[model samples]
Target: MTTFITNFLEVFYVLIGLIMLFAGIESFRDQENPARIGTGLFWVILAVIFAGAKFLPYLVIGILILILGLLSLFKQIKPGNIKGIDEKVAEKSAQRLGGWIFMPSVVLAILSIVIAQFTPLGGQIGIGISSVVALITAAVMTHANANTTYHDSERMVRSMGTAGILPQLLAMLGAVFTASGVGELTAKAISGVFPVGNHLLGVALYCIAMAVFTMIMGNGFAAFAVITAGIGIPFVVAQGGAPVVVAALGMTSGYCGTLMTPMAANFNSLPVALMEMKDNLGVIKQQAPVATVLLVIQIGLMYVLAF
Candidate 1:
């Protein structure tokens, strides 16, 4: 089962690589884009990395990553001429589908859980399988043909621009931080002035650190290892807090940061581009109040529950 899942994942990644390769080709053909060459090269390089990373040497992968960084740093990655959505067609479809338009999303969530909980495929494989299933379900329900699906997928990827890969990059950054003892440095810095033994203060520090680190890094998962190592275990768990509660609340507290930060481009910026919102920060503005409330609530919850 493990081997099968591994093989399946490899194939799935290859398929994704092919899609990105096609996107690169489309970018090259997009005459309207000023940085078309750079954009095309970006996708093509990403495709090669994705498809061949397992076989490629670490040095090669590192070089490719550096190149990707340089491209993004230079503002070479841009969304080209994405076709605007036809309002009339969209409205007609929405009216026809009504609440059924949401069925695909419903299926995606429920099916993912069902597969993860009941099957030997596990959560990661289940998520991949569920995504493909959800895509097929959406296509069938919408009567979308291959060409339509292909074009829509391409446009969506293009619209996402560089933000599409931010999560992966940030996750990698987190791993690098972890390996380089960033957490230990944080621990040393906080230990000097912060009273670590006080349960409430420790809980607050842990939760706040999670949120702030997540905001800085744009990923809760990335923040989790660092924050938990630096703050959670040393202050909370070692001080008699329940391990499970501290870990769970610590992660969600990070999500509060996710809601408020523009650095979380996948969540904040992608929506603005996709919806063509007039205000770039509209999503973050709407989410700030909720995030603030949630962070406070999480800190309280951690204090109450962890102990």
Candidate 2:
């Protein structure tokens, strides 16, 4: 029962992919849809990635990615909503729920943390189980119907359109970077340029590298795995540095990059388009100062504590 509880989150993900695939097909079949082909291609790529990834060979997955990459590069994706929620109804629900609307999320965080700290389920599995429970709590609290969860989730996917899967795709690219010896190559190159014996410079370099790489990658998460493997564990963690502090602070440094990069379209650009704002770079501009300050703070913390 504990094991089943831990591993069942995959079922939720599979359901999400099915929703995208079906919605894509629905759009493709509709004559009134403005972005039929683009929408279909976009969601099909997302759906196949999530649903078929478990069974598909790595080569086939790579080919699928190449195709999707070419399609995106050539401006072949667009949006057309096939279904969605009534905003007024949703607003009404939120208003009625009041403070309780936050209960599910609060419960999820506490449960995940507690289970991870005390149980053999492990942190990742604990979070997964907690997520499933949280969804149930949300469903019951909102008095949602059998199909409400599925339909509501699908509506969100349809609304986000092409940007929905940007984070996932970028994460895959990070994996490919790791597999292609980029991390090893980068480590060698950097080591040749800088003396790793100087602990202060080495720590600075590692944290800054994480931020710079994250900025380029558009995701702190994607950059974390690569940068940590390349420069983090080797120069900092192994050299009498606190591994946990260095890692946590290094990822925090990477988030500074997320704040300033346009490449993080989902974070920086999507809000502008969604809100119909005049300044395209407004979000990044606003976040830049805060990110820089926080990054400095992280660097200081790492220097003081990690060593």
Candidate 3:
């Protein structure tokens, strides 16, 4: 049963790869494509890396990553139009369904909670399993509207484009950092500068580092594993502090960084485009003051309670 649950999570990645592959194929045939071959090749390459990463050797995956970097460097990936649903039809459907349009999303969250609590899959795999559950529920909710479901699915894949798999890619990169002894090297380097015995300074540095790195990486989650190993555990937790308080506040510090950076494209940039905002930095500007205040409060809290 445990093995089966884990395998079910692995299948989620395969499903994502299949969706990317299908989206890449669709891009190749798009009459309105601006970059044609470049666009198709970009997503197809991502599909290959994502689908085959599990089976491929690390050296080969590294090479694929290099190729992907070069493709991006050349500006190969371009945005496509959103072939959105008709507004009147969407409104009518929403009116027909009322608040139930939100039911599947709520169920998705509930399934994640249930799977994590009751199964051996743990939280990470539980999230993957929840995605699978969400997909199944969506199919059932849509009933026999096969054509619309498929068309809309493909459009969403295309709309998100190469960025669709970014969170997955970032999580895998975080795992790679953890496995490659990066944390140890970082810990040693930082300890030299901060000095380990200065509890207040060490705690301050750890929180600051979490925020800075998370801003750079665009994900607090991806940043958390690496930062916790490199600094939080080494600097804060080792000093007879409350581990729970340190971790909770440390992650919140990272979220402050997420609010401030354009690197967090899904959060900062996507909204601007989706809302047709006049300024690209409008969202960041609004978030900056809030993020700064929160970071200050979190740092203060981490220092106060952690001691």
Candidate 4:
């Protein structure tokens, strides 16, 4: 009975996620609501995360992404606001004549894959290499399509500047701490107090912890790395529940955090910047109630289902 209930909830979550994904994409066809485009991207990312960990019990995310991409290519989804096209031609010409500017990174990525295939660095190294390649590819695509000048890139980078880099740096720092075994020690210390038997309490605490950390850290990726190190994998799994549930619920809680923090400059600050708002915190303040309510609901759901 317990197994059947768990499977049913998992299926329900994935189906709802799929519906949201489709709805968000369909909303994009209405150009007046550029917000829908952003919302669609957010749902798609969430779906990917849910599906990636098998928490939702299916691989629907990849299919959703493909469908969204196809809709985009076919112009079913209206393209919102193309800025600065007048100067784009000049920029592209300069880039085309710039002589293999992106070759070095591309070469390193290919070389890394080759070495990984033949050497002992293994799957991890291969994945790392591929990720670097993918990042470079994405950057190239962005640059090519935007026809952005080096100056424009610099300006955009400088606008967010240090704020943009902080999350990635913190995440890397978290990884280093985990690698040094500090996470293991921390997990053990936390486990000593919590004791890991009550699955309901464990899931609730995990969701709460993830929300708080994400609020502080601003990026859920960093929060996930740190919290999972401290409580998630150890406490939740030891309670005989699935790690997938813990990770999914924890990440959703992090999104709730994203709604309240100025640290999530992409979500919070970008809108302010684009709108030229006098106060950076305006977006955060406006979104706080919604975030809080969602966080509460997510916690309750995690407790009921994950446990």
> Which residue pairs clash within candidate 3?
none
Worst 10 residues of 1 by lDDT: 169-178
- Score every model by TM-score: 0.81, 0.77, 0.78, 0.46
Q: What is the C-alpha local distance difference test score of candidate 2? A: 0.80
Best candidate according to lDDT: 1
Q: Which stretches of candidate 2 lie over 4 Å from their true place?
A: 1-13, 22-32, 52-54, 82-84, 213-226, 240-243, 260-290
| Residue-wise C-alpha lDDT for candidate 2, range 8-96, written one tens digit per residue | 55565575678788767765765666657776777777788777666789889788878877867877666555566789988999899
Task: Report model 4's TM-score to 2 decimal places.
Answer: 0.46
**Clash count in backbone of candidate 1:** 0
How do these models rank on lDDT, best leading? 1, 3, 2, 4
When sorted by TM-score, best at the front, the candidate numbers are: 1, 3, 2, 4
What does each candidate score in C-alpha RMSD?
A: 4.3, 3.9, 3.9, 19.5
Error of 4 at 73 (Å): 40
Please give, for residues 1-307, the per-residue lDDT of candidate 1 as tens digits: 8999898788778878878887898899999999999999999998998898789998999999999999888999888888878899899999999999999899889998999899998877777788899999999999999988888777877888786887788668767877898767877888898987899999999999889999998888878877888888878998999999998999999999999899999899999999999999999999999999999999999888877
> How well does candidate 3 score on lDDT at residue 90?
73
Question: Candidate 3 on 1-307: residue-level lDDT in tens?
Answer: 7787656656776776777777777778776867767777777877787677778898987787777767677887775655677899778877877888787788889888887899777777778877767877877765637677667666788888666656666667767777998877888898777788778887888888889999998889878878888899878898877999988999999999999999999899999999999999899999999999999888888889999
Please state the error at residue 166 of candidate 1 in Å.
1.2
| Cα RMSD, model 4 | 19.5
Evaluated with TM-score, which candidate comes out highest?
A: 1
Residue 110 accuracy (lDDT) in model 1: 90
